[model samples]
Target: MSVTMSPGRYRGLRNVSLPAADTFGIVAFDQRGSYRKMMGAQASYAQLCQVKSEIISALSQSASAVLTDPIYGMDAAMRMSPRAGLLLALEKSGYSGDSSYRKTELIPSWTAQTICQVGADAVKFMVYYHPESGVLAEELEALIKQVVARCHACDLPVFLEPMSYSLDAAVPKASAEFAAARPAIVIETARRLSRIGADVLKLEAPHDIAHNQDEAAWQASCEQVSAASAVPWVLLSAGVDFAQFERQLRVACAAGASGFLAGRAIWKEAATMSSAARANFMAEVAARRLDALLEIAARDARPWSDFYTLPQFDATWYEAYALC
Candidate 1:
């Protein structure tokens, strides 16, 4: 399917400023509560920032872009690696808390304009979505439209990540029932959000945790997601184990995924290791793992830019943009 967006937005998407714009093998470190949970109870903000920096330093050379959050590690990440392409996460965490159930909001300090000023290549928003949640779905669509308009005015590309979670009172979040329902829920949510005009879609692989190893089921899920997506879509690791994520990526790419924008599977261990060991671990362990994924993507992934016929650059066009 062809990408449907304005010419400016197309340029913005192409200008990812990565080693390869066609294929996005991005390393994401934009976790909050999840990172802390993966580490231990004592994981501090400072430690998170340090580990994020180490991951960027180690893997940025192999990765096309890096996704970082505004609060903890973005500044240090930007300062530490000027050449690496960066995408800033705009949303605040804790939306799932009982007090704030289904309320997704942007971080107070950073807006689309402000994020662009920080030299970000693009901006990303991760929304937890469930088709059954009527009011919440409407609220999220409104929020996405506002952000897309803001980003259009600023001429920045926006990536929308729609993740599924159960909202039914009777179905436990981790139960077999929730797992059984997630693949369809995820595909439908992607179709819904793709119509809202995001430049890119960062999706969770449709296979549930239990069915991840089922190749036939995964291929079916991938085909459904690829058919539903209007824009270029990439798969997120979703904290799955490295081998599982690697298999998921292969299946996704073969079934028409652009590539991957993975986080935890690439750098989860960095959070748990001591500061002294973090750098070495990132360089040796994390970098190698990322390289393996990149190899897989290069072998099987489709190029996002190839989906459209981009206009040839001429002297007049360069003059129009004041590039001369």
Candidate 2:
């Protein structure tokens, strides 16, 4: 079944969340459990929020939009991201089931309408997805379709991120075999999830940098992903080192990607530093890195307008708009 969406509602909102160029150089500050681990197991809530304040304050300057959770980073992004747009995370920190077949757990008492009421510009949901998950994949797909319907009803654009993982216990995720299989898995996942009423597909780079260094093959895989996705796609960093992630970003952009929504690769180093040091690093290093990525995106990435037809309206368009 085809998921329903009101294109007239979200196209303008989606354009508002992106920069003037419409290429996405988004900041992913939505890490929850991973953020706690970065801040250390014993780190207090204040300490974690402070870290968010420092990082989001600095990089939001260069970013087109900031992706943050409602728990800790929302306050920081609300204050710091004056020029950039805000995308709030709707799901919980981690998955529910075991690593073999993970399941997304959305936060209780949160709905798309409530997210809009909270003053967010857009909604983001990240789910663990795989083509071979059988029943689990169908369940996740259904959940995504439901979320999309809710969001579109409220006229909010949804950024859907589907993270891929290894299904076989014998071949661990870090193994070369898994890396070799990553391109096909990622491409097929994009094909599957892009049809589920998402306004934008936040995707993994099809080429695995750790196991492969072939730039040509990397670009080819990225181009395939671009072709497979029905909507415009942006690459996720997936916590690779900055240097390698930079390389991946370039290739993806060259292969017709819209831009990126990255997290750890840019600011993971500053999470462990003192407030002053973190501030300095974010301002000097992370901000500059974002500037560079934005430069790359401006040069090569396709604008999101390529996917959605931006609506033209008369001055009385809002008279017909539904506030419910």
Candidate 3:
């Protein structure tokens, strides 16, 4: 079934412009410092751009959209794959200088109008969120309100991603305590962010198999997240291996997720390969991985448009923002 939306919302959705009759499949290459760590000491900004461009050229052919970061990869992405829908990352990472918990900061130069002028399909911000993260939550919420208002005025869609990290330096990132606390944190974060008017949410899977392997519990957690979100929500890969993420996506889609906006999981292995082998790996291995995920989404994921009630717009909304 199709959803009716306000003119502004419609314009935003149209900007995403996935293929007809297919699930939303966004290939995200928007990583910054974290990605460099993944690539080890040899990583350079130039190499990162080259690798991202290669992935877009090879994998975006079958995917719905591609997410790029303005700092390094946006130009190459747009140049290499002009037809793919582009979502530009608007935040700078590693603001906190701590490995355990990152604090996100918006890029000083990009604004809603600037992003739209650059032909982005949407603008995305990644906020590091946790209930006990001191004053960070308040700071992020204020920033989000400004972003949402500006995007609405410009008739551009805005995606909000709230990622949970442990604030305690003593706690190991992969510890059971961290995993156990994640589902509830994720659910609350979705609800709070959605209430502030995010057009779309990029969420982590509620339960990790390493800590919570019960299928029933996984379904229950996923249900809570789905119920909490006021707008359409998609799953993020969070650097899991491809096979594990495939399983998580199957579960998440069955529970209520719209689709996925994933990175790393689809191409991390390619990053580790020798430069001579990287292109072939992206064309053969990474492209196939992307296609496989898209197939799962087509067969099982919900359409984002189906998640919300249709909005009614008065004549002025159309006059001001309607696409001609």
Candidate 4:
């Protein structure tokens, strides 16, 4: 619960407009060609730079927020420009002889350097709690303090993501799972995070979204998360696709998600990075959706040209009138 203060001057970031309250900002990681390396192809530094350039160029002058994690090392991504916001993974390394978990030396040093190298105001650090590490919440809390202290010494703001550990029964794979668990466990996760110093509470949402059946269940979980932390809550998309991505965004925004720590959907398409033709194609698609929504939100008096058709407005009528 103790918040650390920095020794250096606090550089307040300029006021950047938040994405529409109903709109969950999209941030694409995987600039390093996804977390796990491919079989044959190795993602080179040059390729990562190319991806970074494309991301910056695509951002244009729009005030959208972005979060990019490093590929192989923190240096590559840290050295590059952060057009949106920058984030680096500080995954916990399992404990040694003692029951305490250790922060990978690279994490504390690189994270500190990242904030010092890149201005702290524009940078944020993301740490994942690995349950297999035998590091309990108390130990994890201390690690967070140490990490934050490093950031604070250099005057940086930190955003934290707290997750539950689970394994797929059939596959025998360990992963961060929060979707299907008893309410108490989820609440405990939130409470633990709150006891530590978490600026933004990023948690997993309920997997299934039924029409009316699971509303109370979902709401109960959400309330627990909110009650456990004073910080605003955002959801990790859990790797949803484009259509599902959009739907999930709408649902999250409606469910009071402050923002999203999303990957895949924004970066999944090869076209989004590879070729100019592909890049433009993806950009135009995004622009169409974003433009339409922004136009509606901005409420521009002038009649804007409808680049993409609004077929889904009314399903039956939309289906009947194919091209309006």
Candidate 5:
């Protein structure tokens, strides 16, 4: 594919967000509801921030960027000084509606200007989606377009994450029927959302994890997702185990994924350990996972530059650039 080098502001910020040149090894610490569910009664504000800060501190140095929530990790990320660039989550903690038709909402009183002013390199908004949701799908797509316009206006890249859920109440995600159809759902979701103009995509595994164990199927599904996405794309861990996620990452990278913006598979186990052990795990085990992921990504993953090359310009180029 040919690359387009556009205005330098957006290009530069996008490059900063991907520390590994054009590849992504973003560490997603922005999770809320699931983070609480895992910790149960212990999911206090203090505990959440602590976990986010600690593990992020341990892992951020290796990641391309850190995806943080406004309420918790953003402050710590700005203060503690991680080596990675920051990508703030614009969506609220969880989605509206049930398993049938989920809708995502932005965090109250937050805007693209807030993200740019806070020195974030990118904005991430995740919507639980299925193109078949009709008006609900339109609503989510509208929100994404609004976010993309705003972020691009601010010269910040937006990483759109479109999560697929079973719309049929009868055929839940755990059912065999749902698993069989998940690949198509994810690919179509990518195809639909790609047209919204987000700079990067952080997507879930296209193939079903529990029901499908075939490596060939995994590779084919990932290739389809890559082909469907017009922009660059990365893999998300999606609460899978480390070993399984590693396998998925390998398949995805080889099939044309830029890299990963993973969370649970890399650090969830640390949350369940004791405080001291948590610190140890973050420094040792989780840190090693980051290394492993980075190595895989650097080796087999496609670069975001594959989609758009960074702008080349002279020092005086800024004089002509608009900053509204």
Candidate 6:
């Protein structure tokens, strides 16, 4: 089966010289609590140092450009290294329950300014879970166009990560139930986003692993996503183990996904290491994983590997190094 996507929406980063069919990229970062969360840079600040090192090391070794988030916020994170090419993970304006703050906050303004600050080297500006906030598509489109206009005014690139499925904002919801229902809903949602001027789309893989929820069902959903999306498709890492993760990667690639925007998996390993050592470790594993995924992206057939042949990287490594 052949899958396809629209390529006209990508911006900011330098174009991959590789053909669209052959090009697949990796992006790794932490968004929870990195150096950005802590104010003072103390010797005892082992946590910040470790995460930063892992990110730096990963950026240096891999051909894939790393997209860094403030983890907490840019001002705090940048105290360590402000010059890195970063994707300002712009928080949606109204979600914080402070409409007044949205107007005055650093996110909308600083994101635009930073794009200009970076100029031609514009790092991507990504917004997570925009549609699910109960914002109308027309309203969402206006906000996106506003951001895009701001980016254009500053000559920066904009990358919008839209989900193929919608989720209820009400808390205390059942995650497993949501996971089970997400696949079917995403197909139409993907189509809706394509029409709304989204520059890029990031979607979750299907959760059903049994015959009733087999890989083929997910592949079908991927086909739907690719067909409906007017922009490029990048699958998200759903925090599965290496075997399951690789399977998802293959499904995405076979369905014509451009690449992925991955987090936790890369940084989880360095959470416990010293700042410098963590960076070096993440760089190596990220490089290995990048090569492996790219190999999957370039293939015409899905090659199921023997689990024994796969490298031994576990959840502990992720907690310590993969996530922020």
Question: What are the RMSD figures for all models against the true structure?
Answer: 3.1, 2.5, 3.0, 14.2, 2.0, 12.2
List TM-scores for all candidates, in order: 0.89, 0.94, 0.89, 0.64, 0.93, 0.67
| Alpha-carbon shift of residue 163 in model 4 (angstroms) | 3.3
Q: List the residue pairs that clash in candidate 4.
A: none
Q: Report the C-alpha lDDT of model 3 over 1-324, residue by residue, as the tens digit.
A: 334555555655655645563346888888878778877787777887777677667767777878888877776667755567778888876566575556677778877778888877788888888756657778778888987888767777788988888878877657898888889889998888888977889999988678877878888898899888887788999889899888888888888887899988998877667766988888778888888888877777777767544567676654555431
Report the error of model 2 at residue 43, Å.
1.4
lDDT scores in order: 0.77, 0.84, 0.78, 0.45, 0.82, 0.49
* Tens digits of per-residue lDDT for model 5, 115-213: 888778778888898988899989888888888888777777788898888888999887899899999998998898988878778898988788999
lDDT of 2 by residue, 186-230 (tens): 999989999888888898888778888999999999999988988
Candidate with best TM-score: 2
Off by over 4 Å in 2: 1-18, 314-320
Ten-residue stretch with the least lDDT total in model 2? 1-10
Q: What is the C-alpha RMSD, rounded to one decimal, of candidate 4?
A: 14.2
Any residue pairs clashing in model 3, and if so which? Answer: none
Q: lDDT at 156 for candidate 5?
A: 75
Per-residue CA lDDT of model 6 for 172-192, tens digit only, reads 123556566666556555666
Give the true-structure RMSD of model 5.
2.0
Q: Write the per-residue lDDT of candidate 4 for residues 1-324, one digit (tens) a residue.
A: 223322231121211113333222434443333443431256556655565545434542342344555444344345433443444444423223332333432333446545456543433444434444454545767877776666545554455665444423432112223334434554666666655554455566644332223555666566665566555555565555555645544444444455455555544554334567647854776544444333322332111111111212344543433210
User: Which of candidates 2 and 3 is the stronger one according to TM-score?
Assistant: 2
Candidate 5 at residue 159, lDDT? 87
lDDT of 1 by residue, 1-324 (tens): 564444555665555534454777888888876766776777677776777677677777777778888777675566555555778898986585453246677888788888777777788998877777888789889989998888767767899988777787677656788888878888898788988968789998887765456898999988898888777789999888898888899899998888899988988877777777887888888888999888877777878776655656756764544110
Give the poorly placed runs of model 4, Cα more than 4 Å off.
Answer: 1-26, 30-42, 60-63, 70-108, 120-123, 130-135, 167-179, 182-185, 208-220, 271-273, 288-324
Off by over 4 Å in 3: 1-9, 40-44, 97-102, 132-134, 308-324
